[model samples]
Target: MERKVPTGIYGLDELIGGGFRNNSVNMIFGGTGVGKTTFSMQFINYGLNRGEKGIYISMEMTEEQIIRESKQIGWGEIEKHIEKGRLRIIHTHGEDIVILSRFLQDIEEEIGEEEVRLAIDPLTPIIYNVQQKRHRKTISEFFNGLRRFGTSVVTLEEMEGVEMMPLYLADSVIKLQSLGYGERYDRTLRIVKYRGGKHGEGLYPFSIERGLGIVVDVTEEQINRVTPKMKYREYFEDAKRKIRQVEGELREALLNKIEALETSWTRDESPERVLQMFFRTELGREI
Candidate 1:
């Protein structure tokens, strides 16, 4: 398997073959309030937390505004990362392609060959600022420049014709939709295209939560893979029986924890390994 740069969005990496391909450009497009900026922030913040350097180039927001929004969403350590020189935020006007090109060149020279994560919130303005006849040349050059910075997550506003160019050019394209149905503000994410990888094909339900950013609901397929062909309850039956030997309130607590695991465990560990660890550590006996 090729090395991947995890997007750091919960439940998203699994859907995109571990994560975005290393050094690839990924596009995230959505309408207003569909959490596009939050998605970009989460990707950069994920790298920053891991001590990996990140650069955020914002055409829509100022440095102060971006920092304030990051803190409001519970990413309070963003300022510290900036102070430590692990992360940088550049605020620029998108319409000036000449100036933006110079900034990108300077960034590339400074970053050199280091593996860094780059985030461009709402790349629409830059693309839209160019003449229609020059879009191909302009977008190609822009995306090529971004690839030099290692892995990148670029956000785009989903206008009727504005997205087709970027969507076609990106290594992987993720579409975020705001499905306004009645009183609910339901949102979904779909993998529009992945150049060289298999990806989830359906609309994945997701929610934007405080501190968590975008939380994707784990599909039944993801949960079921932990125990192939075997139901979780049947796989853990022997472990449950072992828990019966555990007496008092501890017994009930153990059983409840097991029940929770049966429904909520989405990791790659097999049920046998999980149950073995559970019995060995919790009950002090092998099942």
Candidate 2:
């Protein structure tokens, strides 16, 4: 129960109890404008400032683009880490996996290398890399390789379905959400899931301020919070059970409506009659 990786995002740190457990892959999922990339960068930049070696492999933007933004985000010192061999920013196309695998191999060979932080910004492009042929085995191998690298890691994942793959592999998961539907937008973030650590399910509001960095305000009121090291299986099972009951009730109601509509005894379908028919047919009540 050693608390490590401590994200340093005040409220988030308290909720997740330190930070993401060491040597794990974490999915940070959200829509395009939700600032998933920025959050990932912030996490990586924080690690870099601590002199922890890190590799930020990005498919969406080049190394220079992220570095430039890092400077604008008040992390210009990250460039010094890159020069000191404590950080590496790589941009890859279809062959990113191969390149990253080789890089990991090199780090393995290096004698006396410090613990690394690996951030693969927006893991969505990997789908296109293998042309959707990537299976569970390949994905598990991907995560396994990361853990083998022996570092604290967070992988940004752009997902289609809310149920995504890397979440199953990662020791933690943070989901970034946004305000505004269209052009005008503001960013919000939440920890959607985590394994082997405590994390809150409630949405914690965050903002990227020019002077303050990624500040998380816990609100003046006490918000609902989950236990650190909460039982993952139990929570998920309870959630599934609730959803199943809801679905069954919805289906039953639909069937009853169809049956009532088909009955010749039906007239205007009044509120009272509908209630009466529902009780009589479903609950065995009198006409």
Per-candidate count of clashing residue pairs (backbone under 3 Å): 0, 2
What clash count does candidate 1 reach? Answer: 0
Give the per-residue lDDT digits (tens) of candidate 1, residues 1-287. Answer: 46889999999887766789988899998898889999999999999999999989899899999999999999999999999988888888777665456757877875767889999887887777764667677777778888878999999997686746888889999999987883333788888998765567767788888998999887768534432234455766777887898779999999888876665444455688878888888877876
The residue pairs in collision within model 2 are 6-18, 198-229
lDDT of 2 by residue, 1-287 (tens): 34468665556776665677777777777776666666777777777777677777777788789878888877888779888988788787645564445655754655145567777776766644543555666667767877766544454545454336667777777777776754222566778777754455666777767644667766433233433222233433333343344445664564444333332121222344444565466545533
Off by over 4 Å in 1: 99-103, 160-163, 182-185, 222-287
Which candidate's lDDT is highest?
1
Point to the candidate with the largest TM-score.
Answer: 1
